[model samples]
Target chain A: MTNLLKNLATTEVLGINRRNQDYLRPLNSPSAKKIADSKLLTKRILRRSNIQTPELFKVIRTEKQLKYVDWSSLPKSFVIKPNQGSRGRGILIVYGKKKGSEQAWIQSNNQIVRIKDFESHIMQIFEGRFSLGSRRDIALIEERLKTDKLLKKYSYKGVPDIRIIVYNSIPLMAMTRLPTKESNGKANLHAGAICVGIDIGSGITINGIHLKSKSLLSDTYEPIEMTYDQKINLPIKGIEIPNWDEILEIAVKCQRESGLGYAGVDIAIDRDKGPMVFELNARPGLGIQVTNNAGLRFRLERVAGIKVKNTKHAVRIAKNLFGGSVSEEIELLSGRQIANLVEKITLFEKGKYKVKRKRKKLKQGTLLVKGLLDTGLLTSRIDRDTAAKLGFIDAIKSFNSYEIPKVFNSFEEAQAYIDKMDNTISKHEDIVRLAKITEEGKIRVRPVISVNLLIKGIHKNIEVIISTRKELIYPILIGRRELKDFLIDASKTFTR
Target chain B: MILPNLPHGIIVLLLFLPVIATIANFARYVLGIRTLGIYPALSLAFAFLLTGFRYGMIITTLVFAISSLSYSLIKYTRMHYVSKITVIYTANAIFLILAFTLFTQAPFFSNVLNLDFNEINPAGVLLIAVLIDFFVKQTVKKDWFTATRSFIETIIVSSIGFLIIRIPRFDLILVKYAWIIPLLIIVNVIIGQGSNLKLLEILRFKQIIVKPNPQDDKSS
Candidate 1:
């Protein structure tokens, strides 16, 4: 229980209760929710603001309108949904009129939806079964926008939408909800769609999670490389979403126009219409955080008090803080652990580092210490205190008794000191390798011992020079020699 | 501490509802298990209280079974929604009556005559009325699978509620201090105060939670 709470704090995982009390209830105004509840009202608001959204074809508010409506004049493809539907419920996508039947249409699921089926569905919507609190609602029909080819290839039959969670006009975190066969042509995580995390700086997708309908418990989601379709064997990992900057701009603008302090704006790409705003959720789903492998609380706390001039500036600020795919790329490809410049790593005792034991297997005592991923040095180094704690007592005692000079003013002086002490200190049985070192104007022979270290999640058996860099703050310094698997990004500090 | 002849169990129902609803809420918010709803569970529990557990359970099971059966039989027919609901309810009455008759006549259930269906108080009738409201909605809106799922969840919650009501210690304490009912606001306040992480969400967001934390080791 304590570990769970610690992990929650470490990752800053936001729960439903916390999200509602902290974010939604405080950040979202009642009017914002009022508009969000009514799809027609949201569309009108977004359209009036000149934000791009799918055009509204017709709205069936009364039974009389349904009776008098001309069925043939409707567009070839359109979407009919309840004005107050939640979680993508009570939505019907019509591909076109069915062959040889004027009153019939082909649905996204390839089922023939006749006029009777359509009317009955509208009547059901009017019956208030789909709306929250089961209140009576009208049906809003919008022109069905085709998924751009990039997203179309990934979807089975449904259109995909990118949800950008904007807080204080800054697009903080984003994930694209890709429709799957399991989702039944609906792009909802609960309905079994895949959520792929997108880099806030560049709209490139990273790792994703899929909640298959069989695993409806919401806790049991599978990490996925690609969508459910076997036809498209390509992974959806690095697909760059088109119009990403524009999408962010519009999403932030939508939040601004709606007077919502925090909101999730759904954007779908049409082959012609470009990126169109689909829906604005006053309370966005918390699953996006899991998809992004980021905690909303952590991100929210970051941009809480920052001021932005406009949507453009906010997008830039968001990109600058949360962008970059360095560690994400490594994780996506190989599932290797990600580390920052400074990290806490686990180190084991000297002989227990990685030595093979023929018998008498014993547990190695481990200690947590700070490490620096320095790019300048070729060989990694550990301090004397850290070495002694890791059972390198003999090596530390031997090096300490050598009476090494404290400071060498000249290069020749340091080289002479190193040449004199080489054979004596180098002959130590514990010293695995010898390496020259020059720092400031001082040069000293440091013992390189092989130590077992756990960085991020990867375990390494690497040689490190033992030195008392009393001036340095970190007990350990990891050089380029041990950082072969990771890419260094100076902008990032700590990754959890 | 016993009540002074409160007519119908509504007053008693009111007194006990806060505790039962909070239990349902805790099951939902903390444990991530959901019942049909809080009100329905409360009604079922009170119904169980007045009618006695054994007969109440049997009748509840029959009501759900008959509700499912009647809806399936008439669903394909060209009948209006209201008419369909009325027909299913009529079928429910007939089935319950027939089951009661069989229970009275069967040698195995010869003592069922003492189950006291006739002596049921007005509270029992009101509780059944509330339970029937869900039945009516199920017939109009839900399929057999979802209706059955809700029925089972409701039964589980109602059973817990029934057990709470059966405990005489709580009844004595609560009836003597009936003002304790309003004190559920404190419980509601504690529960309503969101923002603290929910227990179930810890498992739901396990990935984020368990993600390794790299200390902000800013040392050189």
Candidate 2:
């Protein structure tokens, strides 16, 4: 119990009471805070500096003005945000207009919102239903961002945005907020979206936290076991974020421009446009500390009173101070030391079944497979011919015996067929279809198998995705999920 | 420590201190520090009842004017903010003493101000000076612009509180029914829960709330 208290003390998670006494009250100025609190003013200030934000379409200030709004003339996909909105409140996301109906628009949840309901929503916004203190607030209609293609799989319905904490014009820490099925397409940490911590320098994800539990998500996509309860881990960490340098630059500039000594910059990466600043918070919530598994007080104290020349200098200082530490922590947490992108692996079976090689200088089943580490692929993939040589044909036959429903097959027939099959057949019926585009731009969903393979003298149970490597040079591709224990070096061709 | 032989006015004033302190603390905790301005204004009204209106008005005005005026001088100084503030407070104290002596003793000043020195309570003057100094200290810690803005906001909030406390019938009723204090507590608690947005944000954001449909408004 004492140990737990000591750990909690060390974690430096700032509670609301302490945050008010220490961070917010001291650092934040009332005038700059006023700017952050009002989205319209914030946008105006940012736009004057030529910072790119979502394009604003219209704003409804008064009841008369709200009544005068032509709902039909609005874009099919746009966002209605309250000027003084708090958290993720007062933002209505219209996914698109319902087919052939001008009055009906589909919301993020795919609910068909009628024109009357939409107008009433606007009126409610005008009445300050969503704004801070429930005061009357103007609704800002703006362009909704399209989710980046690489991030689409991680998000449920809404766009994934990065929330960066910038203190003294330095991008101190960052978290990538992904909308979960439970969050109802809202990228709010409190609303159940996963907050994955990003290494400030490398932009690689290090740790993730389920906001409510404050539990750490492990390297292998499992939540670290805690005393009270355990949570099912979502695979979030280790993948490198696209446009890392640009994102950090914007966050630092946002703090400097906003006149806020301490600020939280919410940036969303659009598919074509790159990183765009959507919101700024003077009193950014303390949930970021838990997500990063690092105390904000330490980071804030480190940067306090230090003269920052410009945003570029701040970014460089931040990288030097806060970066590289997460990579070391990742090594400790996963029990896997850092490896380069390319590594050499000796592929050998437990015992020799038969000889099927051109070079029979040594034992029959022994082969040296040059492996290239691919973090993008979740499962380790191997050429189909290699699997045949490795005597995995029997396993492949058993894997194929499980009945899979064809695209045009009826649900009832598939269910009936599954019902008629034995428990063993039904148990292994889970289908994972992983699609990837080839070098020639052909999309192929490869066949997968859960097999025991030997790589670098360690026997690992890995799901191997089978693909025809007729045109490929290397026969084996080691994915991130199986590389937890091994570090790869691209320079070394075949090092055990 | 209850002295039954004490005068009614002293006892009432003693009881008022704790209740007023509680109210000030409530304002600080729930509504943020900027709302601390309301306390001195409310205190002015009570001071009027306790030590007469003339003395209370004089102290309030003296504090507000001195604090607001100090901003212009403080801006150009290179001294540390704490040292600067201490200098301002010392100047305010000297000015108050000079003003009091001139108002009472000097025939020219006495004629211009037209006030009776005998009616002013020394305790009320001391209380007002301390409260205003504290308010100034809080306001001036911020940047010049924010300090000025909050300083004005504090005065506005105080004036509103003073006005509410000065209602002739309400003042009498409040003194008679101290039970209303608990009701005010409940009201404040509810307001604390509700006032999550800054008042400035509501006003500033109104500029961007444009009318979307010109034809619909013209028809109306």
- State how far residue B219 of model 2 sits from its true place (Å): 69
Best by lDDT: 1
Candidate 1, TM-score vs. the true structure?
A: 0.71
lDDT of 1 by residue, A1-496 (tens): 5766676665677778778888888888899899877888888899888988888888999988988777788898898899998778778899998778888899987988887787888887887766766689899888998889888888878889999999988998899988888778788876678889998877899878986433223346778997766466569898889999999999989998898888999999999989998888988888888788877877787888989998888888888677765345656677554566788777887656653344334345777777888999899888888888888888778777888776666657767776777778867777774455765446655667888887876789889988777777788899988988876656556543
* Complex DockQ per candidate: 0.29, 0.02
Candidate 1: clashing residue pairs, number? 2
| Backbone clashes in model 2 | 5
- The C-alpha TM-scores of every prediction are 0.71, 0.49
List pairs with backbone clashes in candidate 1. Answer: A17-B195, A18-B195
Candidate 1 stretches with Cα past 4 Å from truth are: A8-11, A212-219, A324-326, A331-496, B1-13, B28-34, B65-91, B105-129, B132-153, B212-220
Instruction: List per-prediction Cα lDDT, in the order shown.
Output: 0.77, 0.64
C-alpha-based local distance difference test score of model 1: 0.77
lDDT of 2 by residue, A1-496 (tens): 3443334434333345455556667778888888888888888888887788998889888878877888878788999888988878768899998899878889987888886666666776776656676576788899999998877667777888899998878888888888877788888765667778788867887666654432111111223222112133336777578898888988887777788877899999898888889999988875565556566666766777879887777877777677654556656777775564655555554245234445435354666667777877777887777776666665446546755433314445444554454344424432233323242344433445554555544666666676665775677788878977765434333232
